[model samples]
Target chain A: MKLNLRVWRQQNTDAEGAMATYEVDGISPDMSFLEMLDTLNEDLILRGEEPVAFDHDCREGICGACSLVINGDAHGPERTTTCQLHMRSFRDGDTIDVEPWRASAFPVVKDLVVDRSAFDRIIQAGGYISAPTGSAPEAHATPVPKPDADSAFEHAECIGCGACVAACPNGSAMLFTSAKVNHLNVLPQGAPERETRVLDMVAAMDDEGFGGCTLTGECATACPKGIPLPSIAAMNREWLRATRKARR
Target chain B: MTLGPSVGLMALATRTERRTEPQPSMTRIFWRSTVGKKTVMALSGLIMLGYLVAHVMGNLKIFFGPGEFNAYGHWLRTMGAPVLHHSWALWIVRVGLLAAVIGHAVSAYQLSRRDIKARPTAYVHKRPRASYATRTMRWGGIILALFIVWHILDLTTGTVHVGGFEEGRPYQNVVDTFSTWYGNVIYIVAMLAVGLHVRHGFWSAAQTLGAGNARRDRALKAMANGLALVLTAGFVSVPVAVMTGVVS
Candidate 1:
């Protein structure tokens, strides 16, 4: 599929970005979105022009590294990641605009590359268990119900992609934070530090400069991992319960 | 900043204890988060939604004719009996509603500002993945604000009434206002916005308040949509009755 592309370009984090147009011809419908970008970059390098810069790794989609808003939709029109999106989704000669994630805390590094370290900081703040490493108990030592285990596993699928933050209108990380909160909080091992965990992680999320969740459901919709929207609600439950429990 | 699985247990323990060991200061930290702001929005929104339901029920009394409708309006002032005196209880309710409205509006505006702050630059291309009702919230709020002002003038304060603006005769004033084309237009338009706003707002409130979970999410959504329709129909029915010459 031959396509016209309008790609964002910026020299560095401090530089202003603009949409620069490019043409990619002789594209195969089976090529992945990242492959298509690679084709475009090869052409740019061949012509002695600066190639569009973007982030991508493990194009299989689990790495959550490839970040771009294609034709305005995060990860393109599908409910999958950009790397998982293929040229077959678009018509020949279609014009696609690619850009980096827009967030105050996520500064543009170059073209489509954005600094998503804010997510890492948020997770560091509270998204973990306080288990010691000397010896380990069997995984089934503490029996967990199917429902709780399922919920935890579902939330555990989050890849810290920053797509939730990018997709939210308020640029809120509630979805992302909630996924992590619920993931471990639901587990038996995660219960020991659950109260302190919620309190600290919420504070960290606030510090990261991500906007609040307004329940737009876009984050859930735009999520490549199909993270359910209610992970946020579950997080809210944990936060509230933790705060009240703190009074004791 | 990331609290990756590799982080030391000592660092995590110290951070957790320092945050939650001494005091309730963690409560303060909680409110500073985007989730905290959303919790505030949900709570204040629920307060207002409660008022809307009551207000609409009171409005439906109009169909019972002037005697019942006027009596209902008068009852609002004398609700608290001799202990509080006339209008005291009404004023208290007004104060509560006013506080909720302020909380909702101010939190909304501040959160929006934070959202914009989170995204310093515009995306080269954009597409909305949220519902229409979800997207219309900000503008819907503005319309409702203006409508509240106009509504008070036309009925409560009698400042911008059509024909005779009787002080005690709320029924007549209501009829007179709706008898005019502009009144119906303003009212119907505002009511429509109200429906859309409530549809998205209530579901969002439920999520933020942690009343929603995987199973409950569907029910909360259905309830929100149902409430919006009922409230809109309830409020608009008064004007429709007046315009059709059924109640006048």
Candidate 2:
């Protein structure tokens, strides 16, 4: 499949960026979106031109490293990560526009790559359970109810890909933070620090300058992991519970 | 301006020093946190929603004729008369509604500013996203606010009433306001805005308050839609009746 691409190009973090157009011919229908970009980069290299820069660690889609807003939808027109999106989703001669995540908290590092360290700081604020460090503990040591375990597992699917932020008109990180909070806060092992976990992580998220959630569901729609929109409501409950508890 | 080893040490020192400062009170913390501010928005929004339900119900009393409708208006001022002073209950409700409106608007304004700041850039390829109600929330809110000001002046204070204003006669006042073409236009437009705002706001508030979940999602959504439809129809009926000379 042949295609025209308008890709965002930035020399560095401090440099101004704009969409640069390129035409790629002789592309296979089976090639992944990343592969198509690879073809473009290879051609650019052969001509000694600077290639478009983007983030992608594992093409398998679990790493949450690939970040691209294609044709105004995060991760393109598909529900999966950019690496997993194949060329077959588009028709021949389609003009695709690709850009980096636009959140101020996730600043553009270079080209289509944005610094998502804000998510890291939010994780560092709490996303952990108190357990022994040296050895693995017995899985059955703490009896987690089936419902709670299921809920926790559901929220644990968040890959921190920042698509939620990219898709949110407000650029809110509520979904990402909520996923991390709910993943641990539901388990018996996470009981001890549940209140502080929510309180501190939320504080960290705010300090990082991310926007507040308006419940537009754009984040959930953009999420590759299918982290449900209700995850945010659950987190709100936990935060309110923690706040009331802390007041005493 | 130059990077030095001492700069790193100075940063570490300041970090440590900041930790030693007294912690803020819980109320301050709650107001400062994004999650907490959302809680405020949800609660205040619900308060306004409750008022809208009663307001629309009261508006429908016009169909009962001037004698009954005027009596109902009088009843509003006379409510809680024996237990409290005349108009005292009404004053209390007014104050409470005022507080809710201010809280809702202030948080919305601050959160919106932050949301805009978070996403500094826009995607070059723009596509229509989210439901119309969801997308128009901010603008719908502004319209409703302006309508509220005009509505109070036209009826409550009789300051903007198109015809000769009379005291203690809400039936004639309602007719007078709706008599003008511009009045009918503004009222109809604001009622539509109200429907759109409430359609998204109700369910969004549920999520913000953590009352929503997968099991309850459908029910909450239905309730939101039902409430929006009912309120809009009920409120719009007043102006429609006046325009048709059914209530004049």
Candidate 3:
């Protein structure tokens, strides 16, 4: 299949960027989207032009490194992350426009690559357990309710893709931060630092210059793993309780 | 009433303000920027939702008897956790609630404007599948704003004009006002709007904070919708029944 591509190109993090158009032919429908891009880059290299720069490690879609906003969506035309999307989703003569996540916090590194380290910083703030790792306790010692365990697993599924930040109008990362907070706060293992976790994560998220969540649900809609928005609500409730407790 | 040119100038001025590039002031960013403001709004809005549930339950005391209703109201007014009527307790509560309401409203306005600007063309997405409530958020918000103002004036300051109506008669005034057919109709419509708004708002708010996952998304949405329906229906039925002579 022949396709017209408008890919974002930039020399470095500080460089001004714009969409550069390219035409590619003979792409396989069975090829994954990233593979198709690989073919395009191969063609570019053959023609002595610079290959389109992008981020992808595990083409299996778990790492969430393959970030692109195809035709205005966070990943592509589909709800899944960019890696899982296939070329078959596009038509033979499709003109796909691809760009990096256009968020200030996640600045464009080169072309499709973005500095998602802000997410790392936010995570560092509160997305971990502070308990000592020396002793191993029995799994059933805590005996958490089945529902709480299930919810924790669901919240823990988030891969920290920055797609939510890109998809949101306000560019809020509340979904990302809240998911982490709720995941830890829900579990008995996470109970000791629950209050501090929410406070630190929330403060860090704001300090990182990411926007707050606006209840738009676009992040969830764009999320590849399908993280629910209710985690945010739970987090908010937890935060309120924590704040009240702290005040007293 | 004859001041037409002044009104025109005022309209033009407001339009220009809307059209002007959003000047990023410190206060503006805190209140209207995508992240912080929306987080504050979602958090406060959730708090208000809690208050609404409790308020609705309190309002249901009218069915128990006038003495019960009035006594309930009196208890709420008189009760203080620390037993200091002359202290700053009441003022602190009022300030806190006021701040929450203001934060929620300002964030909503900022978000509403952003939503308008984010999609220049209406329904740009090929699939237009937003719920009816989601679509009518602006309208519902406006109606709710009006309802809230009228509610404050009617109950708090006694601005709602009805002949021979006395002040501080929240229960009696409610019954009297709702006893009229037109009043019942208006109240029912507003309550329906509230219900719709709450349904979407609750779920969407959760999504904003990032707690929403696919497994619990439907459940949270249903729960929110159910809560909204129950509270709105219960409250609206009071006025509706009285208007229809069924409550007497």
- Judging by DockQ against the true structure, name the best candidate: 2
TM-score of 3: 0.63
* C-alpha local distance difference test of each model: 0.86, 0.92, 0.75
Q: For model 1, name the residue pairs that clash.
A: A104-B118, A124-B3, A172-A211
TM-score of each: 0.92, 0.95, 0.63
Instruction: Tell me the tens digit of each residue's lDDT in model 1 across B1-248.
Output: 78776567767675634444555465575567667778888999999999999999999999898999999999999887988898999999999999998988888998888887876766657565688998889999999998998888778888888698998898888888888999999999999999999999999888887888778878888999999999999999998898788898
Cα lDDT tens digits for candidate 3, B71-171? 77666666674565742564666677778878788777866665544323221123343467776776888898888787777666667745446655567
**Order the candidates by lDDT, highest first — what do you get?**
2, 1, 3
* Predicted structure with the largest lDDT when compared to the true one: 2
Error of 2 at B186 (Å): 0.9
Find the candidate with the highest TM-score and give its number.
2
Q: Looking at model 2 chain B, which ten-residue stretch has the lowest summed lDDT? A: B14-23
Tell me the number of clashing residue pairs for each predicted model: 3, 0, 15
What shift in Å separates residue A27 of candidate 3 from its native position after superposition? 0.7
Would you list the rank order by DockQ, best first?
A: 2, 1, 3
lDDT of 1 by residue, A1-248 (tens): 78999998899998877888899999999999999999999999999999888998999989989888887778888889899999999999999988888888888888889999988888888787887767777877899999999989998898888888887777788888888999999998899878878887888887788777778888898899989988888898888888778543
Residue-level lDDT of model 2, residues A82-184, one tens digit each, is: 9999999999999999999999999899999999999999999889986757788888887999999998999899999999999999899999999999999
| lDDT assessment of candidate 1 | 0.86
| Candidate 3 lDDT over residue span A1-248, tens digit each | 99999888889988877778899899998988898899999999999999888888888878878888888788887878788998999998888888888666787789889898988998887788766567887777788999898888988888888888877765768788878888889998898778767766777776666655546677878899888766666776676556545421
